[model samples]
Target chain A: MTTSSIASPDVDAEHEQNKTPVSFLGPFCTYSHQATLLAFPDTSKWVLEPTSTIKEVFDRVQSGAAPYGVVPFENSTHGVVTFTLDGLADRAGEYPDICVCGEIYLDVHHFLLGRRPPSSSPESEQRSSGRGGEENPKGVPLASLSHIRRVYSHPQAFGQTARFQAKYLQPLGIEFIDVSSTSRAAQLAAADPKGESAAIASELAGREAGLDVLARWVEDREDNTTRFFVIRRKETTEGGYPPPEEEGKRYKSLVSFTVPHRQPGALANVLDCFRRRELNLTSINSLPSLVAPFQYLFFVEFEGGREDDHEGRISGVLEDLEKVAERWRWLGSWRRKR
Target chain B: MTTSSIASPDVDAEHEQNKTPVSFLGPFCTYSHQATLLAFPDTSKWVLEPTSTIKEVFDRVQSGAAPYGVVPFENSTHGVVTFTLDGLADRAGEYPDICVCGEIYLDVHHFLLGRRPPSSSPESEQRSSGRGGEENPKGVPLASLSHIRRVYSHPQAFGQTARFQAKYLQPLGIEFIDVSSTSRAAQLAAADPKGESAAIASELAGREAGLDVLARWVEDREDNTTRFFVIRRKETTEGGYPPPEEEGKRYKSLVSFTVPHRQPGALANVLDCFRRRELNLTSINSLPSLVAPFQYLFFVEFEGGREDDHEGRISGVLEDLEKVAERWRWLGSWRRKR
Candidate 1:
């Protein structure tokens, strides 16, 4: 497979392209796996490696076993997946060859599933019957948020539903339960016949567990989506391939840093460099630097490839910031997501 | 409430000297409520304002409805509670009124609750026989992880148990379920019998539902503990609160800011001011600015009261950082957790 096949017909016609094998964490059923499949669909054409953790996937991609890997970057509800960020930060220096090539957006859905509803009491049966199917004989209706007493879902699902849980369930005396996955939520509801319990999972999971649908799109926002990154190992091009000249081509660079503890205006001084250089930052987030309990590690993704701009301009800014930063790493840049 | 009557002599005597009320998000039985109760036992005298959400608790303290509030800052398993961070960031300008006074650590325990084990099943009989003379049959010991198809707990609890679930249950095809609270996990498990499902919750919650304890401390780490913050809505006095200052007194200041993207060393420049002035930063976290999809708001807590240090030094640092920041706020300063 070549870049020509994947690129848009209207773009530079002679641009050279290469297909790289990609890997991700998966059993073929997870959202991460789905992202991987979506990012690179021709499994047979490009080597597809699936690992068990985000670190393993990164290692594989960095080691060249697979040229690229896909992993979840962050979820709107769950914040950042620290493991992925940490792995990238830890390997940023050694794997100067790696860069985030693209990103994908996935909509998350939580469902409730179970084998059967708990056996109903005589009173429950009469009450449900009178409600004309609006309520389960022993189970609660999927739409009746108030009747729910317990809810089960994966941590990611729970995060996505955080606002909903706070608004409808927490106040209504409902209990939000956490499970390993949405499928597990379905299984638990299926195994029980209780009317007071429900699970947040996927519809497919509900089918697998023989559970009733309790709710759909229970997230705080209707536009619920998770962003994933596609990272590829750095490669040095041979002399035969021609370089393309195009203004539209773009790359994203990532960096991590820790600032001096006693510095009052450390972060501000750092931002000034960007303002003066006219560089556009796409996104930035800081997580607790796992190595130091109270310290922080910032992950920043910005527009423009490092090589596209003046080297002195970037170095000059970095030097000024270094006085206050305990450490810093410039993750390589890559073409914007295709 | 008089400070003299509420101070505890058993622990640190100094912490008792300047005791104050703490509010939290709750309806009396929630985890945050319990955590607050444990951290501050003198409920009769110290005000315990239970609000509907963590934001409410923060607001109540900021508005002076209560002097301080105890809120769940983060979980060992789940990274950050975005809502809490967002709330704190939203009120960054009030830094002079609120500061982190102390931190609390608590262990989490999970349990299973259900109806009396049915005597007809061999598994039920085995569980009953193991009870050692108890009339009620205890929960049946799981034959294997594979026998468990579904599990439930609160979202935070589920995140903490991820390693355990992946190790023992994922291969066996166990699914996780999310619920509002552990207590509700017990209620749902109690209501269901035929399903091969269980709830991950506190033993106290199980006992309340008349369910047998199937497991305890089911998290990956036995030392699993959640840290809570005691934030006061008052500025610290200058000159270190005068002589005869209570022992173990530590001060903290909080701030928020946004900076230009992609400029190298932007953060370093901000830190330079602090390093030149000699202020120690305690903690920092960044949350997505709710108003903008890509922008972020950073929450930083550091040592030294704003008043203790002359306004010139602090304001000078702020002025330098302000050049690169879209907006910034000073939350306030107070003694560290006593």
Candidate 2:
């Protein structure tokens, strides 16, 4: 898992010599993999490192096992991934040299992948036996969700498809088997050749694992999506994203801070720093303070980049925010996903 | 599952007749049950309803199956319970008649419950065969965490005890079995009878389920606590708590609002409404908008009851807030949990 910067401006040389490896929580071919590919897509060139857990990805970044790490931050249907946020907060304090350098929004569509569709219909029988090479030549047949004895998936995937599960599977008394990752679910289904198990995973994962797609886009919400963050060492040349000078690009800055306890309107005072500067916050989440009750640590993402002037409003307001906050840390400024 | 309310003011009648049934996510003997008992402690008189899931608890409240619903909202180690938050938001939109009337904070202590200590040491041998009457006349022996084959508990319980699991169970290659609730885990371990399985659950749950406490306070953090909300139909006379007129009492209001998308500082404008009146925000969490990208629904809790007037500031500020927000809903204002 050795990694080196692809700093050469020449694209060919950059691809040839510095095959920068990026690590993500894995067994391979999960949504995290898709997000990594979407963010840096020269498959043959860039090395991909898959770790066992989200914390491991951060650990690799901190230990220099890999220069960059990708981890899911939030899902449209599931809200924020608290562990990811907590891990970031903790590692920031422990390893001051690591930060979120960029972010990617990955639109997720889960497919029920299995050895064969549950139904015994002629169409499904033919498709199950058919080589159905590239492109799944024959249209796949629908499976009887009720016949699914077991479902294997990451908890979040099950959460995203909760409505579907309740409507189609719960009444039939299907057993849900929780796995560490969606890809692990796919692997489990593939290994269970008896076709009694199915996994809710990306289409890419099914293909990579040589499994059939019993159902497509099974998520309850039409727009199931997940946001990912790319974390890298502070000294890296390419901060996991394009520079602001890249044409037609806009960026957002993430900031973490804590306010003194027993201070009335303390949060309002800090928020005013951004409001007065005309910075619109995209998201805000708070965690209770471990040291004191009724106190919190806030993580905020706003519309302007830390380096961007926004007509000189960004830097000055950030300076004032530092003064108002009991403790503050600028996470990073990266291209905002449109 | 028949339920009837005990509305009398007589303490004995309140205990014997009113038996106000309270609902919580179930398999029984979990932290939710402990919290419910802590909130309403006449166990013999008050009916206790245990729903199958957190969402079921909300559904029961919305459908009038139960007048009072108790659900965990957040944990100090795990942060906000997203599903609980989502259920609150979803039910609010579907059934505007329901509201959060009060809150309870319960200190959580997890114990490892098993049939017997996973060892044959002299102390354990004496207890393994010893009826060890009443309170176990002799102290039980310690178990080698490595010998345990399976650990069962809710995900949050496992998360709160990650360090212990990593240091002990992981090295021993123990299997983690996720259950609906901690009490369910205790029940499963009790049913096993072979001493190979242990459960991470409350001490009270262990006692109720007739399981031996192999280890006490097994959670990594001693200060682990969970905050719960009491939901009831809006027509309830008491609103689930003593009125603000009670001596030495304070109240907090929970509000949800949506600001105009694409409006610069729209949230700031709405927040300003609270700030101008000197209202202090206790916490704020945002959920992504389903209608548009980057838009959010903000849930904010502040330090004032809806009925209280800060020299007429409450009404004036709320009126202005309604004007600024595209949509607003006052969830409720009840006694602040100390």
* Model 1 lDDT per residue over B127-224, tens place: 31124335432232333334456676666676556555655666776655556566666677777666466777765556556665554456645545
* Prediction 2 global C-alpha lDDT: 0.72
lDDT of 1: 0.58
Q: If chain B of candidate 2 is superposed on the true chain B, what is its TM-score?
A: 0.83
TM-score of each: 0.62, 0.83
lDDT (0 to 1) per candidate: 0.58, 0.72
DockQ leader? 2
Worst window of 10 by summed lDDT in candidate 1 chain A: A125-134
Q: Give one digit per residue, the lDDT tens place, for model 2 in B156-186.
A: 8887777666666666777776665787787
Give me the TM-scores for chain A across all models, comma-separated.
Answer: 0.69, 0.85
* Candidate topping TM-score: 2
Clashes of 1: 67
What DockQ does each prediction reach against the true complex? 0.24, 0.36
